[model samples]
Target: MSYSNNAVKVFTVDPLNWQPWVETVDVKALTPAQIDVLSEAPGGLEKIGPYYALLAHDPEVLRERTRLFNAVMYGRGGLPRRERELASVAGSRVNGCTYCASVHGRIYNDLTKRTDVIQRIFTEGVDAQLEPRERAVVDFSVALTRSPERVTADDLQPLRDAGLSEAEILDLIHVVAMFAWANRLLQTLGHPTRDEVVLV
Candidate 1:
């Protein structure tokens, strides 16, 4: 999925229907610094889509941000992949970032081969009833998203009780926290709509 600013393309199953809340960096005219950041992106520029393109307006920050994103969500170990994706979706849903939530939900469904829980979440929320394990993760994520400062050691007991190790707990927190930050950023900088077609 690597691509240069001059020739960018990704095979998409469907086109997005909205644009960024703020203008995105012009990938076709990326500066050298921005190009470097895009290169460090996990799958290169083509995989970044509009969100990272917009973030790339500040290359130094985007580079570090992308590195952390790739490591926390895509890197192996600790939490199961589905749980990590659940954390992402939960945080996004709690933060009311429908676009991010939906994207993660689709990935979660694909990975778990089940859409029941995700459907409940999409139709209801992070608070929608879930399996005990899924509920634990979502509860932790929702708590963090709604009130991070109030979180305490006691707040972690559920995840611990749910069979998550300390490392897994750390990964879950990272996933939720990252999405909490990113969800707000996207809410402010981008939006979803079925009103128009945007062919990337």
Candidate 2:
């Protein structure tokens, strides 16, 4: 597979598979704590994939991480879910995390029914052509992912100008920041492949 960030590749809305580089915890041998943590995670027990299993090595960390993840992504109010998904896609795209991008791209497409935008982003880069509002979200997410230190009040103007409220902008920032962390964990722990990947 091409590792280059700019290389054009097909991105599908369908679930992509991922595999862990390290040995993941065996589901059958899971401890009560690990099972509890995994149960609270996105897919719950039956869907505890290799990634979650690996993290389950430390049930406490995984528990806290799962709680925060669920709250951030599934929380009520503030930014609309679709824009949050868009920000995630932008961050993953910038980080070169194909798996994260594909997953979030699928969510974004499901929410907005705009597969073309995700297709363009995967084919192009974060600078892919998009609507004004989407452009603002993508640009901010890319900037934050590429260089968080360089982002400033000026950087947020575009979001505000695009009609986002302060709360929504804050939500956008949180989503981008979360993806920055999430993408790193995923890419560093494993690699995306078409082989026997644990489908989420």
Candidate 3:
């Protein structure tokens, strides 16, 4: 299907798929380097999709991007995995990146069993009511995503008060900041497709 950002409705927490605006590299025609990059990507070669295929056009860039994303979101011990996912969801929501939000929201739900939180976010938005810690996380993510330059150390106080340590707070910043770039890339390069809304 053709890609268009406007095609995917907002507030959809269901798992979604992307469609690239430009032609994607054919898996069969991939160079050895491109194949190597996809092999190391999150889901590996078997899982590479249109987004990965499109990025495969520049194997070096895609390799670095994939590594950075994996390190930040899937690396060990800085921020709790759930919190990292939460920051991602919050940032995606604020940026209106419905596909990103949906993907990460599913992960958050799996981690926390709090489908209610994702439900509230999708239905009510970034300002939706949340438990204190979640509220702090979502608030900070929103502020950073909305305007990074305006954020100050003071802006970090809420997260600190919510009991996050310096390391966790730093991790939060990294995740949210990464999403700001990720969301934009997803929106600018393609959009969520409506044809297949996988509920998994």
Which is the leading candidate under lDDT?
A: 3
Clashing pairs in 3: none
Instruction: Residues 36-107, candidate 3: write the lDDT tens digits.
Output: 999997688888778888889999998898889988998899789998999998898888888898889999
lDDT of 2 at 120: 90
Q: Which stretches of candidate 1 lie over 4 Å from their true place?
A: 1-18, 46-48, 195-200
> TM-score rank, highest first?
3, 2, 1
| lDDT of model 1 at position 119 | 80
Best by TM-score: 3
Comparing 1 and 2 by TM-score, which wins?
2
The worst-scoring run of ten residues by lDDT in candidate 2 lies at 1-10
RMSD of each: 7.0, 3.5, 3.2
| Candidate 1: Cα lDDT at 142 | 87
Clashes in model 1: which pairs?
21-189, 21-190
User: Mind sharing the TM-score for model 2?
Assistant: 0.90
Least accurate 10 contiguous residues by lDDT in model 3: 191-200
lDDT by candidate, in order shown: 0.75, 0.82, 0.86
Q: Residue 69 CA error for candidate 3 (Å)?
A: 0.6
